[model samples]
Target: MSAPLIVGSVAYTPNVVTIWEGIRDYFAGSPAEMDFVLFSNYGRQVDALLQGTIDLAWNTNLAWVRTVAQTKGACRALAMRDTDTVFRTMFVARAGSGLGGLEDLTGRRLALGSRDSAQAAILPVHFLTRAGLTPGEVDFLRIDSDVGKHGDTGRSELDALRAVLDDRADAAAIGINTWEAIGRDELMPGALELFWESPVYSHCNFTALPALSEERATPWVEHLLGMDWDNPAHRPILEMEGLRRWVVPRLEGYASLFEAVREQQIGSRW
Candidate 1:
């Protein structure tokens, strides 16, 4: 028999090992027995995927776009979390700051997360541009604590929020996940409040090239989608992975990110 199918994921946190180990255990003795390798960042993971060193890559939205760019749309997005289907970016400022909307950002200071981040950085800029704000119109304060691993987005975005609270920036851009993580509009009356939110987009996905055949891919996807959120044994892993269930990727959900990448002239490679 051939070797187990290999999957690549970035080591974004210590618990990542636990998440994959639990998943590997779940696949034991299945028709598509699998193993995993962790990379330090999405760039290395994408490189491994392209070089055929790994059969599948768990990729962030930006990494997925970069992979598509490199493959010229030859790659496939196999699956994604349910949460990945409706991701959005939020432009926030201190509550009662009188920053009404995207247009209010003109000539104002905007703090952004890492330059590589799609939600906090790329899509935020795209939204600003859509509002007719040019590059020179907003004084951008980029806080890039977590540079490569697009995971742990909270770090940079939280810093951006601090920039707003401390008066360094008039507003900040961050993911909706980050917004919720901070308790949303109810966190505090005088703290952060959302001024504008980008339209929904997709997030992380399992990316594969043509080399990973359908024969090998089909059963794996089937078993993945079978992860029942109600099953006590499956619940922990599902919760840790931040999804109730895995589903076939929504290709259309990536359209905004694709547009943003193209408009920004972002290179195909990370």
Candidate 2:
């Protein structure tokens, strides 16, 4: 049998290596083999998937939405990390900045993650609009180290937090999980506080081209869902991906978020 080509972004190479190694080991024990190609941006990754250069891609929800919007449902979701199913974006402030809530952010400087970060930038904008706020209403400072990986590299999130510490912004938008992870790092403590959280939304998933065969998809899905969390074999990768399990992909979970984004665009147009 031929090898499966996996496509993904390059910003998170450490985590990517973990995932690729795990997949390689899983498939090595099976009848088929797999390989991967890392791209620097989602546009290239999505384009490759569409042009059939890669059989499957682990894509962010934003990338998947772009794909579906462009292709009109020509792609299919295969599986996803359990952690990716529900994630929230958090608005944070310095521990004693006196910025009590979303309403207090008016005219205040705010640091946001990367421009392309759905969790830290896009969805936060949606939530802000719902809170009766607009991006221009505040001094928007951008922390843009990991642009294409969409905050998955943690660079943008960390920079946002540092901005809060340095008083660059009265508040910042960051991934909720990344905030918690850094807060527990023992090296960083009590420097920032969480003020608000965006409604949970889906994040990452595996996508397949319309022409992908079921025979190829089945083993990939099976191995993913069957990963033994309790066993030593899959522990490192699971920890790297921040998941204890994997689940079948579901596109419907993103409907509310998509609606919110679309509605926000409409409001912007007027």
What lDDT tens digits, residue by residue, belong to model 1 across residues 1-62? Answer: 56788999998888899999989988888888899999999999999999999999999999
* lDDT, candidate 2, 83-174, per-residue tens: 78778888888776777777788899888888778787777777777789866887778888887776778788888878888877788888
Q: Tell me how far the alpha carbon of residue 159 in candidate 1 is from the true structure, in angstroms, after superposition.
A: 0.8
Could you tell me the TM-score of candidate 2?
A: 0.89
What's the C-alpha lDDT at position 168 in model 1? Answer: 97
| Candidate 2 residue-wise lDDT at 177 | 79
Backbone steric clashes in candidate 1, count: 0
Using alpha carbons, what is the TM-score of model 1? 0.97
* lDDT accuracy of residue 180 in candidate 1: 86
Q: Which residue segments of model 1 deviate by more than 4 Å? A: none
Each prediction's number of clashing residue pairs: 0, 0
Task: Tell me the deviation in Å of residue 41 in model 1.
Answer: 0.6
